[model samples]
Target: MRIAKEIRDDRTVLSIQEDRIDAHNSGELKNLVLKTLEGGAQNLVIDLARVQFIDSSGLGALLSGYKNANLRSSGFALAGLQPRVRSMFELTRLHRVFDIYPSLQLALSA
Candidate 1:
């Protein structure tokens, strides 16, 4: 669960450096997202370019972050999803629920 954090265009970009987001480290991802939002990040973008795989727990973690962000009237988005990882979101129909971009640059611009 190595996540890199940076600020771009007033948005907090959290880059997942791991290849997979599964049951083992989903909790860490969830906690980090919550903590980042709680720390006053109004715009949050998760960069998942490096993540090639994700399970239900991983999706749940991200959904939790999305819910919390909405509760606070903040922005939450996902960027650079690998094809395989994107398919999971599609299969679950989560792709429609999330603001997804092809690249971090596109997400930041939006």
Candidate 2:
């Protein structure tokens, strides 16, 4: 999955370095996000700027992360979604479930 993590301004920023998040890597992604949450990152911003493709498993992983964060009364937001990836969320109506931003700066500010 090639995930990277950084903490800035009291928030955790998890960035996916891979081009795709699919069944093959979704589990890894989910586990990492959960671990980050367990590490006490209440404000999380997942940067998908490098991700150009995603599938159902990817969506599930994101939702799972969101649920986990919410359980802790934390924040979870997605940033830098490409148009195609954005469309998938819209098609699945996940756009309503997630707080998405067009840029990392916007996500962080939000």
The TM-score values for the models, in the order shown, are 0.98, 0.97
Poorest 10 consecutive residues by lDDT, candidate 1: 1-10
List the candidate 1 regions with Cα displacement exceeding 4 Å: none
Error of 1 at 94 (Å): 0.5
In order, candidate lDDTs are 0.97, 0.94
TM-score of 1: 0.98
**For residues 50-105, could you state the per-residue lDDT of candidate 1 as single tens digits?**
99999999999999999999999999999999999999999999999999999998
Per-residue accuracy of model 2 over 1-110 as CA lDDT, tens digit each = 79889897978999999999999999999999999999999899999999999999999999999999999999999999998899999999999999999988998777
Regions of model 2 farther than 4 Å from truth: none
Error of 2 at 57 (Å): 0.3
* Leading candidate by TM-score: 1
